[model samples]
Target: MFGPQVFLRLFVRINQDLWPWQVLAVVAAIGIPVLLFRQKRFERRLAVGLMAVAWAVSGYGFLVGYFGPINWPAVWFGWAFVAQGVLLAAAMFSGGVREAALPSGRFVALWLIVVCGLPWLAVAESGQWQALALFGIAPGTTAAAGALIVAVITGPWRWLYLPLLVLWSLFSAAMFWVLQAWWLLVAPMATLFLVGAGSWLSPRTAQSPD
Candidate 1:
């Protein structure tokens, strides 16, 4: 369960006046690929659209306590948007929609270690155990669950991608909540870049044909 302090910190950070420039930058960064990438129109559209929706909801929640009255629903919807975005990106990169091969086992392993394992370790080392448990542990657990589900639905190698995408989305969300800095936009921005690049490099044609 999330702690009150964490929510308090997030509320304080987000409740500050919104910066129009920062919002524009985030939208632009997310929009570029949808405009440029024609090969994977469906995937790009889905990813960009979900990201836009999540960003708008988060921004609105920050501006007005739309959630303050019925907070759980807002939080649930917010995360649902993020989860959908993550899954859409995962499917795009993991050959669920198009012919995009999953990242290599070694690459996927390294990605998970850095994105998920390292963050958890860093939080624990810093003696922020509650934060670690809430943000690091819980997210890691859900990521593992997502990975398991992906593996069952796809394959073991495909499962590895979920942790990467989930961790990326979680870090992006945290940055937006804690810093209120536009630079935090880099997390998911980089994630989209990686997914597109990985798909290009390792085309899904390599997978065994059914």
Candidate 2:
């Protein structure tokens, strides 16, 4: 949907414009998951709800507002992100994630690493503080965060929806790589790794009586 030059510029520019959001996204990324691990009554709503906001903001704020000015297809992507946000928000009430397996200690750790690792990736790849692609502010981080959420939560559409997220993860990684954002490559890999790990471990956990 975008040329490499345009995509790179989009990442750099949006990050600069939304610098404060980096702190907020990092805070939410770390806090919300911990609450989810506790399996708090309202944690599910809060966690996924945070993710929905990320998606929507990335759609409207980044894609529609920023990227659209440079690339025409970004407007369509903006709407797609908005739609994805709605679906993600709706997932909170579907009883799917609620019924899905609770995260194992390892699963929780993996998820945390994926979320918390963003800054390192940003500094290493972009080599500029202002270009940090913080979650909710940039598309790649947003998609990775969303995939991480789906990985731990269980539901009827769990399998159905995961591939789409993973696909986005790949797409995001490719986009990052186009700009030589190497550390960002770990995003999709880490996400898919967790997804695979969760898939393998969950069945056994579910079948085990404990």
Candidate 3:
């Protein structure tokens, strides 16, 4: 009876020269968000499938010793934001789909400002303000926060969240060189796909008694 941790450790050892945490970080990033929001069984399965793919990719990277430690958590979360984008986009375009009410423009703007601003504050408090001067704040944190704010204000335009999730994933990948943030590459992609598929296949509208 082997567990994920046991397998993960084994993979790490085999990879030797490479950092295995990156792989784990990415998988967890994607897996956690999907698990958080997946309301349908089929969608859960799809998300799981995507995670499996991510794991396999990480394993391959590990075996080849092509690993490094970066801000993988930030990267993964960034992809989660992309998933949110996709969901929002879908909600906007799909005809049969019931669009959730958009958030007030003021609310969205205010939330976006907060989302973008808080990371700077966090870094400043940590004496990492100089780091921000160089790399800026982590985009994943800001994007994810903004998307969640939007979702909350909009009252669950679940379908519109996908693009944000994709954006998160892409951002994470782009930052791979900066922090070797591999999690950004894998996690959000898997989770967002799961959430998206679930949202897509769900009944168009909830029914009410006549």
Off by over 4 Å in 1: 1-5, 8-103, 121-126, 133-190, 201-210
In order of lDDT, best first, we have 2, 1, 3
Q: Rate the local accuracy (lDDT) of all candidates.
A: 0.39, 0.68, 0.37
**Highest TM-score: which candidate?**
2
TM-score to true structure, per model: 0.32, 0.77, 0.30
lDDT tens per residue, model 1, 11-86: 3343233333335434533343343234555654454343334434443443124333434544554465455445
The TM-score obtained by model 2 is 0.77
In candidate 1, position 197 carries an lDDT of 46
Count of clashing pairs, candidate 3:
35
Clashes by residue pair, model 1 = 101-204
Model 2: residues with Cα > 4 Å off, grouped in runs: 1-6, 99-101, 173-183, 198-210
Greater TM-score among 1 and 3 belongs to 1
* Predicted structure with the largest lDDT when compared to the true one: 2
Candidate 3 regions off by >4 Å?
1-68, 71-79, 95-109, 112-116, 133-137, 148-210
